[model samples]
Target: MEERVILGTERDFEAFAAAFSRRLHAGDVVALSGPLGSGKTAFVRAVVRCLHGADQSYSPTFTFWHRYEGTPAIDHIDLFRIDDPRESAELGLEEALDGSSIVLVEWWRNAPELVAERRYEIEIEGSGNGPRVVSVRRVT
Candidate 1:
């Protein structure tokens, strides 16, 4: 299923994430696509806060991957720094996607092959200080 939402405030986005998280489970992959400062990391943080009950997730743009402990683990990944898609092998992505945790990948376009077929794709469109148009789809 796919849904399009307009988020006028940061609180609205968090509310949407909280509702969306209820549909997620371990082994699920969420691909976040948006321009810089489009609230990709903020979305991840919201989802993590809802599921893991904490906001410890940071953009793994430098570290590539960060895992937060919870009932169903959260594997947050940022591939913006990857010059080669093959480098994802070193990030233990396979382990994260092995169905033990929920995986959120920002900049998944940098390494599309690393993403599983059955996954959720979220695209956020925004400019200036306007409201964001967020499109969420299940790409199974």
Candidate 2:
């Protein structure tokens, strides 16, 4: 199933994220796909804000992964810098993804093998400005 939304403002985007967070829980993996300058990190931050309320540890471009402490917890991962899928093992990615926290992966196309087989795919179109077309789909 899929839900597509056109968010005209940042507030709309955040509100959408907040509502979207309601449908998630522990062991849920979210794959965020978008080009550079897209609101991939913004979506992550908004979701984190909704889920944990005050702890939004969106991944820095250089970092491979960062975890935010919360009830269900959140694993913010950026595979953008990963040169090889083998690096996932070195990063203990599989360990963190022990079906415990809510995993959010950015630039997931860089290493699809590292993500869970069943997951949500969020695709954001339009970048560096107002109004974004967002599509959320479940792959299972």
Candidate 3:
């Protein structure tokens, strides 16, 4: 099933993520896809905060991935710099998806195969300056 919502402000966006966090646990992969400046990172930050109580969120664009400590640790990954599927394999994404933690992936389109069967696929649309439309679907 799919659900959609309009986030009019930063707080609204964060609240939505925080609430959604309750449904997530270890082994869950959240595939986030959107254009640049579409608030994908912001949503990840909010979800991380909900999972661990600290923001400690950063765009993994440069490092490719970062693991944050928590009850169920979060592995934040950015696939924007990846150009090929081989690159993802080299990055050890398959190992990371081994049900060890909650993985949130930005620019997920670059490596859709990494996504697990039980996952949440979220797509955000809109410029950062205005309200954003977030579509959430549970993919099984």
Candidate 4:
């Protein structure tokens, strides 16, 4: 079954992320697609916090990706700069995705081909008024 949520504020986004975290596990793949300032990073931070049991998650926008190891390491990747999935492979994404860790990707459109197979796509849309409409599409 598919689920949906409306994040009316930053705290709401964090709550949503935490709820999503409960459903995730090692080897899970989440593809985040949306425009800039759409709360992708915020969502990732929340998930990382749930994983790390802290509130110290940072964006990997410029650094490409970051890995956190604990109970289950999280591989957070940002493909905003990458042009294609092949290029992402060059960054070792193909090898990293062995279904052994949770892979949360931002700017997923940059490497759409990388996620052509089974994956979860989170589409974030601006409401213009307030609250972000996050639509989660599951492809298996």
Q: What RMSD does each model have against the real structure?
A: 2.3, 2.3, 2.2, 2.7
For residues 27-46, could you state the per-residue lDDT of candidate 3 as single tens digits? Answer: 99999988999988888888
Please provide, for model 2 over 3-116, each residue's C-alpha lDDT reduced to its tens digit, 9 standing for 90 to 100: 899999888988998899889989999999988877888888888899888745544433677788788878888888877877766776775589999989999987888888
- Cα TM-score of candidate 1: 0.90
Q: What residue runs in model 2 are displaced by over 4 Å at the alpha carbon? A: 55-62
lDDT-based ranking: 1, 2, 3, 4
Worst 10 residues of 4 by lDDT: 55-64
Task: List the candidates' TM-scores in order.
Answer: 0.90, 0.91, 0.91, 0.86
Tens-digit lDDT track for model 4 on 1-140? 46677778878878888888887888888999888888888888888888788855543533887876666778888889997557866786664477777888999888877664778888888744479988887889
Give me the runs in candidate 4 sitting further than 4 Å from their true place: 55-62, 127-129
lDDT of each: 0.86, 0.85, 0.84, 0.79
The worst-scoring run of ten residues by lDDT in candidate 1 lies at 54-63
Total clashes in model 2, counting residue pairs 3 or more apart in sequence or in different chains = 0
Backbone clashes, each candidate? 0, 0, 0, 0
Candidate 4 residue 71 C-alpha distance from true site, Å: 1.7
Instruction: Decide which is better by TM-score, 1 or 4.
Output: 1
List residue ranges in candidate 3 displaced over 4 A.
55-62
Judging by lDDT against the true structure, name the best candidate. Answer: 1
User: How far does residue 82 in candidate 3 sit from its true spot (Å)?
Assistant: 0.9
Please give the distance, in angstroms, between residue 30's alpha carbon in candidate 3 and its true position after superposition: 0.5
